[model samples]
Target: MQDYAKLRKAVEMQSNEMKRIHDVHIDYWKECSMFFSPVRGRFLLSDKNKDFKKFHNIINNTGLRALRTLVSGLMTGVTNPARPWFRLSTPDPSLRESYNVKIYLEEVERRMRYVFQKSNLYNVLPQCYKELGLFGTANLNIDEDFEKVIHCTNFTCGSYYIAQNDKLEVDTTIRRLNKTPRQLVREFGLDKVSAPVKSLYEKHNTEGDVSITVAIMPNEDRDFGRAMDKENMPYIQVVYEDDAPKDKVLAVSGYHEFPQATPRWEAVGEDVYSISPCMEALGDNKQLQHEEKSKAKSLDKMNNPPLVAPASMKNTPVSALPSGITFEDSQSEGKGLRSLYEVRTPIGELTNDIQEVQRRISSALYEDLFLMLANDRRSGITAREVEERHEEKLLMLGNVLQQLNNELLDPIIDRTFAIMARNNLLPTPPEELQGVTLKIEYISVLHQAQNAVALRAIERSYAFVSGLVGLYPEARHKFDSFQAIDEYGEYAGVPSKIIKTNDAASQAQKAEQQQQAQAQAMEMMQQGAQTAKDASQIDTEKLQELTGA
Candidate 1:
């Protein structure tokens, strides 16, 4: 009979504890929903550039520290003698340990310092907690008074486990198999914990069947363990259908809730889910959730109505909801607003990467076309041959680009080149000209060097479509087929100019030599005439002198 009475008391105590815990958990979820929903909604379409830095900074600066603080607080609330809340109670003669708080706070501060050192936020946010070391050491003595049996090894730097052993030395097998809150509290100290608070940890259980057990503790004060006044507690209430599949519970688990122009709760009395309350409590803040809500609301009201179905189709179902209406239907009809939104193509894994390479190659091909055609007026190569050469060069260029794209430079090259092209820095093909056979060849020196030393090979070849376009401007209208080529061969401009200058110089030299030859021929003819006259006079005198002798 005595045994039965004790059993009954234990059951009653367990029941009350469960009820309180259930209420606390439900409230926590409500706050979490309120905090995350608005942030998510606004962040989806927010200015990613402006807000991304701040968001990243917060996580970098405070992530580990905040995690540690909440974990430690939960441990303390369980071990505190005034209100032992976890499944187990503190050991006998357990006293509220002041040093423990200081210790946990110090650990938190230490983590914050480490986080500051490791993250970019270290430069942005001023050092508000500089003496974290001293503060953490000072608090180390706070939990010494508690009757705690700690199972730990100092050799393994951060592997200690603490638990309230009032009932018995904590079941060693249970502690080894699964860590309990009491065990973690002992090891990490009540000052700084590295685990999630009990309530958040329990919710995590519903999402993933992880073996991690939560460490529960009572709130230190009625104001839910926060430093602020009860009235100032920021809480957003939200309601949303939990459409999560039983198999995929974590799909939306870590969502934040925050208040904005569009309140986290869709309607106050409509039982909508909200993230605002949780954001207020946890300080997960955003600037643009507020801006977008205001913008969306104003844009909806001031915009003219969209187009409707023709009056001839009055009886059609399409008339009830305009065919073009996407966001709204009834009020948007007959306004003739252009549809600015369109469904985007789902990103296929292959196309996203390969397509970027193709685009770069395509741009280079056009540049090659202009470069080759604009400057190739003197090559003995025929217009048709030039066209063939362009085709060959383009093919070669495509191959090189494919190689570059495949070289595993996807992460850096794809995004970087995309930015360059979008900003119009990439060269484009010039308009095709008539009667010009444009040969465009794109070659990579690096790749070609491995095969053979192809010196002065046109890297990017651009040419006018037809040779006749330059000789006869009338053929310009017939010109077409301009393209961009890859960068593989040497530029053709300087070489072509050198050839033209050389030809002109050779012609000038030939003309000067002809004039000098003509002048020498005339002088020789005049001298020959004078010599003939002298010779005739001498022959006649010799004949007379010979006869007289």
Candidate 2:
């Protein structure tokens, strides 16, 4: 019923566009591939004559090491130890008083974490790092099944591309999969086919073939239902070609978004490829060092030369001569005798150059920061200084982290929450909070660290104002004490449960004021009663004096 030919043509067009970008970046990809697997590099594979093998013996993998280090650092910051990866909050600050909503959100977060843990998201996350490291982009697909409410799968680079869209969200994505006919039939519920077709599918079940799966949100105005009705095919399965509902498939992309001007989607992210020149130099330096060492060994072997003699004395060997043996020549007084040629190859400069290149490579990958932390204790560096240095490195990743939050973490959480909501795994919100939408707050160490910069600035400003207030008491009124406390608590990553809401704080203040007023009234009444008793005593003394007269 659906126009299969038209869809295939659109797919082919998208593929061709993506291929063009891939071709332009093939060299960079080859370098990254070689960094991980040297033999995969075009330069290594093109050695049909086996010439490079003889000279370039050492294939340094520092490039791969740097890539892994960067990836690990990113993961560590993203999943910080001090806080959860994400939490739910209300967009309206005043809603903090709604404890029921707060509790419901907390439950949502707990369930989300449980789902992720059950689905093995921790393992899936590393694949994303690999993709990001190699291709500067990562794709994560979220789906649901009977066994797992929310399941996640990672797609490697070059296997998927985004379609044209006016908004930032990915509405359509085309992915290539290699599956057997049997798998396709089983997955898509194609068992309703005729007997002969079933037999044919079973025959080729073992032989897998590549298939393209396109996910798109169809236009509402399109007559897809009419087309299916005309074909008399199954409504959902025939249209989607999958057993699962179309809306359940969520595709999320991480890192740089594709440029609008380009015909195809291309990720322009920062990665090891950004420092390709340094990585290339490191590899070359390593090969050169190996070559120099080989040369040095060859020179050492040629330190002593064997004497050459006429045909009559050809049988004489160099080992037969003694250490101090004198060479005697029957003709020309040994003038034509062979002489030792001293060969000297200085490797000190080569070693220094290699070391310098290694340093440059390390600098390019921010490895120097790690080294600083390693030596900080021994060097007696203060903790504050170490933290400041750490922040400097984290600042470099601010943009990438923001993208990951938007394109990776947020989508994953939203999809998981939606699945849970559909399954009724979340707590019921109170009537007041029924219409309120939950927002995500990232409290991971990296996010907190990002906030720390602004927090530090606030602290400095407060300290400076306090110093002025100390000099002039009247300056205290200029400071907003409560606002400062609240802002500090928020930026300091303090848990919401631990901090009192504004309404509660105001109630406590009013109660304290009432108690103070009652105490003051009781004191006034007690003083009045004492004054009346003193006056009564004075009148009694005066009457006693008059009776005595």
Candidate 3:
């Protein structure tokens, strides 16, 4: 038996530490809050009421729009609009008949798609984008029903720890669950159990709500006891008990492993949460935009300066001035007169400054690339040149793409596979593949582009080496044509079904050679028979000549 109380306490302590770490990056969270909710943004809230009202009246909200576009573009790239985000592979090269594995994986993918669709993952993804943009991290929880698996994001989900050995893998996770006592009883299947369980459920029903913290972690012992059954082959344990009912454990269940991992689209240094530094730039841009509007308003006022008159003439009707026939009183003939003069608002420099600030904000968000493409299109630039430029810009996101592959796409795929396996929704693996583990290969456009750089380098190397080998034959040995082709196929996202296995290719070559040898032997036999026939005929001719003489 495990010490449930002690373990729970330790997990709680760790969760508190993680929360403290999260609090340090609260400024990033504030930025996200401002992006989504301008009225409630901390910046706006901190200003005086009158000043905030002015900001509200003139706020452009271009920053929010830019952030939205950036998030959408990133989501589209990573999710792979053309096809699935990932494919399955195996580490074992010795395994032949990968076509069967492919079929199995395809079925699994189809099932996963069904579950995701049912769970409205399309809706959940936007929440992920919001979390990633603001906090630089997103969490997904997989919950199962009888018919389908549900996937959800827990942006506010708290208290998770990752193993020190692997930064990418999460070791343990805890989530707060709110439920009524009766609901808990039903969930744990305690309604039909002991009288004490029933009484406890009734007592909780009288209360308003109950909160339970469920913790999932790896099992410490490797013993194959009753608790370590085949159903829980991966040997992860789950423990849950009501905070109110501390003495009595609610339930203890099993899982393949902890079903949560922190997926970050980007990171800075070693921090768990690192938002885009561009957010600060966006805030500055907003402020500048407000100031520019204020200056423009002042300039307009200066261009049509307000009328000023002497105290005696102040009582004169303004309608008389608008009629262009102002009549001064006889007593104040020349003393009271209105003068018209320009205030001279220097707006040329201010306009230039505003444009520069806008440019900086756009560059920070990568909107400048889009603007460049748009301008290039108008200029009738060739498609090839535009593509080259776009690719060059994409290089800046190479690290982000890699992080998505490892932290987000790969884990989602693995967890989806695990869910399908647990539900028996996938086809049974062949006997030979019983112990084989599947690996994920991302083939999205973004992923392919990330590999394109290395592929280009390999191509260049091969070209140079082949040229050298033309002059120096020994140089040919330095290149491995087969390995090059294999790598090219992988980087190019070539389908495995189209490529022949080494063993299969060798077998085909051997068969062709045997057919050629058999043909040669048959030809030799026919030629020998013809020669024999000719010799017999010559012998016959000689014998006939002899008999006639």
Best candidate, TM-score-wise?
A: 2
Cα RMSD to the true fold for all candidates: 31.8, 8.0, 7.7
Worst 10 residues of 2 by lDDT: 255-264
39-110: candidate 3 lDDT, tens digit per residue: 332222122222344335435565655556556656565673446666666787556345676567667666
lDDT of 2: 0.57
Candidate 1 lDDT over residue span 46-160, tens digit each: 1122333333323122222332332232222112222211111112111112233223323433332332233332221111011111011000100011122111111010111
Candidate 2 residue-wise lDDT, 43-104, digit = tens: 22122222344324445555556656655655665753334778788887767567777677
Ranking by lDDT: 3, 2, 1
TM-score of 3: 0.70
User: What TM-score do all the candidates reach, one by one?
Assistant: 0.18, 0.71, 0.70
lDDT of 2 at 80: 37
In model 2, what are the clashing residue pairs, if there are any?
A: none
